[model samples]
Target chain A: MPKILIVDDDPNIRQYLAALFEDHGYLTVVARDVAEALQTAQDERPDLITLDLDLPGEWGPRFYRALSQEPELKSTPIIVISAMPGSRYAIGNAVASFTKPFDREELLKTVGETLDL
Target chain B: MAKTVLLLEADSSHADALKIYLGRKQAEVHVAATDEKARGLLASRDFDILLGNPYGFGEACPGEVKRHKLANPLLQVIIFCPRALMDQAMDDFGPLAANYLDLPLNSKALGLALDHAEKCIATEKKLAAYSQRLSDLHDAQSLYQQLFNEVPCYITVQNKDLRITDTNAKFKRDFGHEVGGFCYEIYKHRSSPCPECPVAKTFYDGGSHGTEEVVTSKAGKQYNVITQTAPIKDENGQITQVMEMSTNITQIRQLQDHLSSLGLMLGSMSHGIKGMLTALDGSIYQLETGLQKEDRTRMAAACEQIKEMTERIKKMVLDILYYAKSRELQYALTDVRELAETVVSMISPQARHKGINLVTELEKDLGIIEMDPNWMQAALINFLDNAVDACLFDPKEKEHRVVFRVSPRDPETVCFVIEDNGTGMDRQTRETLFTLFFSSKGSQGTGLGLFIANHVVQQHGGSITIRSELGEGSRFEVCLPRVKTDHARLNAVPQPHQNVAF
Candidate 1:
């Protein structure tokens, strides 16, 4: 099964994605913060990663920098979810973007389209 | 003029004798025996006094006396009743009992009662006049009280000694108990009286006075108090009291100050930023020119310079955004010193690259200030980053240095100072430092640094001022109001990257 890494500071968000992806026949791994997400991305080698912009530990710019600088995560087709005013989060690198309170079906479709699965 | 009396008697012989007696006494007498004859005599003539007999009467003597009185309550009633009938007459007609005499009346006793009635009438007129005057005075007093209480501002009556003698409901609500206290002590929280108090001037000169004074409450919150005093005059034109009204203007004054400073800063920043943009446009032209001349080396260098200059301008634009977003934008208590330190560290890399020594002197024992932490940090960063840039090392210089100092001005105010020992500003530049787009650094600086810095300092109920001279360096001072409220713990933590600067 294709694996998806869902990284968010909020526990509810992590749990909801985990349940949704598992029900949709994809293996899911959840990380609570940027540091944990980086570790999980390396250890699990997920097919795709969904990151929240406003994380508890490190915020928008720092999280985006962490992804671009990391060798393993650089080409992982990362998507950023933010409730921030703008739809895009640009730091040092390019990444797929989605505004927060996004629908589950849309999230899955974006993931499917990007991964071609 | 002749004295007249009318006698109505049933016996004709007695009527003739009574008429003769009255006529011999130099009084005109009219006598009528029958009721019909009496009515005919009354219809043709007016009589001042009526004398009636007890015997041969249709109604009783008491009833006869009452009928005469009913015709005129002011009329004098003299009853000619038998001595035995006097008590019965008094019992039946007490209100009409002006005087009673036995048949063959004693005129001396009648003369005394008439004198007493005349005195009573004069006393009644005087009493009526005095009662009307009292009612008028009552109406005036009620109107004065209504006006005093209904006024919008806090109003009070103060005696010559400056003691509040009376106060309205608004006065009581604002100054706690308004009456029975010194005006200065209650309103200004001052133990000693104010120097040259306007209210005192009114009391002494019997003239009105008004002034705006800064006052502090018991809790030490400051206020701009506007007081108006009008002398309350007595009938002799002497000032017996003073009426005072006060309104608090602390917030309004602060807001006005903020607006003026923001206006100045925005004006200067806009001018400086535009000037920098112009320079950037010039440099880009030069780069294009160099390329057209087939000078690859010069074009490459110009492009590098342009890129660096553009990056600096971009940073300035970000500073302006951060400054505008958080300057007095309202938030909970945040650790201002920690935020200052964060900015210091954030700019440390740049400081290191420029070979400038960067230092922070943040006081650990500092009160938390109510601020948006992200915005406050951004504001501090603008100052620090600008200072580091200005303190860049000259070719022959041993070491360039920039310093950041955060000190407590009591527990309620924190002072942050950013000083640099680079090529400092001249008088003209310092004067126009905060003017919009008025940068001295040409294309290199957007001139928004100090402008945004002033705005940030002002937002926290603090002030920002710059002191600089050509080549000596510049120092920017920021004063931030301290918070004594309960959100102190949350403010002390250093949260990273939530920095307000773009």
Candidate 2:
């Protein structure tokens, strides 16, 4: 099963995303901020990362930049989910972007296409 | 222009010859043989010249003509008399007579005398017209000067050098009579001229220009003013100076700032609301899957998430509603002791959860006070909650405690003081604590609680006194009068926004 990492400060969002991915036969991990996201990404080596822009500490854009700086994590696929508008260009290298109250089926399709599952 | 001549010679033959000679020179001569006829002619019609021998009537003739001449300054008199009395004519008339001619008048001399008298008449008329014009100009200039001084706005006329050439009464009243001072120096206290100056723009284009600026008065009071400039031009249409008028719009701008800040808050809050809505969707998703998959743990967790999110949304909505309106205080007679106890009870549980000790000094028989119980309780709770947060922010390993004290300051007023041993705010935060959207807790604070609390307390004729240090702690004392009409109680209120030095 492909593994997914969910990055959001809100625990409810983390729980929901984890359950959604796990139910689709993908193993899941969660982190509340950029530091934890980086730590979990290094350890879990997830096939995909779902990032939220508005984090408590470092923002999602910083996490995306940090990914590029790490040679091993440079190829990780990032899907940006944010409540703030103009987040599409905030992380230009992300595979897809969705604002809050996102359509569930559409997000799942984009994930499947990015992972080619 | 025909000159009317009055011939008072007392010689009929001489009069006929004089009238004929004068008529040839465009002089309409009227014969006045006696003083009575001369006075009648002078009174009935305006005559340009009086040609007569004053000695013909002895002393009566010259004195009457002198009196008439004083009354009619433009009326010229030519005296013709017997050779013996020509000296007497000169003595009586003085320089007031136009000329003196001996009797048996030589036609050439008489003609010359009339010509000379006509010349005097024209010169005096020209002088009188000039004096009238000069007086009119003086009146007009003074009237305009009065208008300039009476204008309500601050007005300054600046020359090309940007030096004030003139200032109106209102300007002198506020900024002092700063004529010959540099515009920037007097108005803005700047060593150099302001950039993008409207006065300079007006002088360049000969067009009126306007800008809004914050200016300080001579008394050191600040004002928001809308300044406009117009070119003062010479007759050749060259812009020689610029007249700058500044209308004080401080009150209007202050009101607009308040309203705009409210709009700004709403705009910022919308983003937070969107995120909350998404979180709500996530909770709903969890609930739906839990029900579909027969998962009891997920269902219970989903229920708790929904409840918490609902509470957050409800609070935000209420905050928006409360902030949008300047609500009137709904006063009720309520026990003051119970009110303090109720607020302490709410803060006690949170204090314990955070390992912060809660201390209360609730005095006995505090008595009843008339106030809006709903908002007043919220205000007291807000202060206690802030005390807790201040303690939480202090990461130093030490005992943390919050003290809530309620007491009656006097017969007509009550006090609620909340003090905390926590990471207190600096002077900047303390000064702007009650202003719109001023938050010290970063993302954790909504910035609305203290502002709303301050407003509610003020509406109920209360005041908040703040005293805080950088690392020591903060103390917020709220003193509210027993009644809303307690205007005299303000004299007893403490000095506000006291910051600790160092």
Candidate 3:
């Protein structure tokens, strides 16, 4: 089974996305902010990562940069999800970007394709 | 007029003869025989001409003539002397005397000398008057120059060729004091004249003209100026030069820009707000369905979503309140039914244009409510406008209608209800409807209308509630107290989000 990392500042959003992916039979790991996201990515080495742009202390872009620097985690696929408008172009290396209140079917489909690749 | 003359002589017969001859010539002659009498006469009376026998009066005559000349610089004096004594007389009194005669005076020569003295006095008086007038003109010119320089506005005098002839101190300070420079070059840094220049218009029509212009200074700073130009005509009544005066309005323009950009900032912020609303809606949808399924794990997860969305909404509302606190409300005792009728009249035309049926149902004698009529009217307009937009956005094939109704809830409260048969909101939308920046119209909505409408109603000590279904319609009820209440007490009412229910 493929494992997914959910990174968001909102605990509820993290929980909601975790439940959504877990219902689809993908194992889910959650991080409440950018700092924890970095630590979780190294420990779990998930197949894909879902990121929220706005986070406490550090933002998602800085975390993506740090994650890309790690030799072992450099190839992990990232899907950006944010409440900020025009945050689709926020990360250059992310495989896909989805705005907040995104369709659940679309998000799950993008996740499936990214992990398959 | 007879000319007055004083004659000094020691010989009595000669003095009497001379006085008779002068009197016949239209002269008033006063004879002073002794030096003492002559001195007295000279002191007491004004004489146009003085004739003295210097030999008879001895050395005192020359001294007396000098004294008379000192008293009246324009006085004319004639002395009688023998040819042998002429040289000595000329040495002592020549500068003071108008003329000199031989010891026995020739009457014709004496008359000629008196005529010359009268002409000298007339010229002196005329010269004095001309000098006084010249001094007055100089003073007036100085005053004009001072006023031109001290005026607070920039002023410049330009000739027919558009070259600056003169500039006031203020203009000189802003644009360097270079006379004969081209007006356009100095004022606007342009090589050629500006189009529709007020100064050029004044020159062509010979009438005053006014315009607004943005001017750049030598220091490279910009100023918004209102310029007025008038013709400066020459003595021939021809327009010779144009005088332009300008007042700076840079700060006022800056204030207007600041206000407009504030409006723009509010517009841009709506996009971020719309995204947040969508997220909240998604969360709520998950929560309600989880409850229906009775899944414990899903219910726990939905509870977390509820808490997070609630906190974000609270912060957004507080931010809106802080921004709107500056606008003071004007309150009056307004008839609720009349206000509703007025709003309907105002919006009916637009509703008809959109092919939506707008109807009003008012409860007669629905008494007055103390409220800000303008703000309350705006709230009604906002609700009606949303109703119209909802109808337009609806994709259904059914007949669309929006009805505005007003009635007394009780003796003390009035309720305004608006119902629209359009694309209504779902449970998730209804739950977060009154939260700031939540709009179903997507990019077309600023997300501020309903937020502002809710705020206005809240200020009137009123409450707003909505009931809707996904495809059927939505109904909004605004209940306001008819009697006046202390604004402080109204503010004490809990925030709107707490009162809203799904």
What interface RMSD does each of the candidate structures achieve? 22.0, 3.2, 8.1
Q: Please give the lDDT score at residue B4 for candidate 1.
A: 60
Model 1, stretches more than 4 Å misplaced? A1-117, B1-125, B159-161, B187-196, B203-205, B215-228, B245-263, B266-349, B357-371, B386-502
Q: What's the residue-level lDDT of B377 in candidate 2?
A: 93
- For model 1 the TM-score comes to 0.48
Worst 10 residues of 1 chain B by lDDT: B488-497
- Flag the better candidate by TM-score, 2 or 3: 2
For residues B1-502, could you state the per-residue lDDT of candidate 1 as single tens digits? 1456667788889788777766765667888788766767766666656666644566644465467568755455566577887787777667665566676566666455544444444564567688889999889888878877777777878887788899987666656763688888887877878898888898778777889987654444456878888888889988888888877776567555545655665655553454344345435645665667777875775665566557667776676665443332557677666677678778887677557888878777766777767667767787787777666522236578899898887777788889988767777777877765555443235556666666555545567778987778889888777753333332222232233333
lDDT of 2: 0.83
Q: Write the per-residue lDDT of candidate 3 for residues A29-79, one digit (tens) a residue.
A: 998667778899999999999988866435789999999799999899999
| Residues B1-502 of candidate 2: C-alpha lDDT, one tens digit per residue | 3888888877778788888888888878899887788778888988888778766664666778899888888888888778887777788888888888887788889778777887888888899999999999999999999999998799999998899999999999989975899998988889999998999999888899999888888876667899999898899999998999999997677556656767888877766677678778888988999999999999898898797678668767777777665445567899999888888887787688678999999998799998889889988888898898788767466999999998999998899999999988889889998876766653344668898899788767688899999889999999988876544232222222331111
Ranking by TM-score: 2, 1, 3
For candidate 1, the chain B TM-score comes to: 0.55
TM-score of chain B of each: 0.55, 0.66, 0.52
Off by over 4 Å in 3: A1-117, B1-18, B21-47, B51-61, B67-71, B251-502
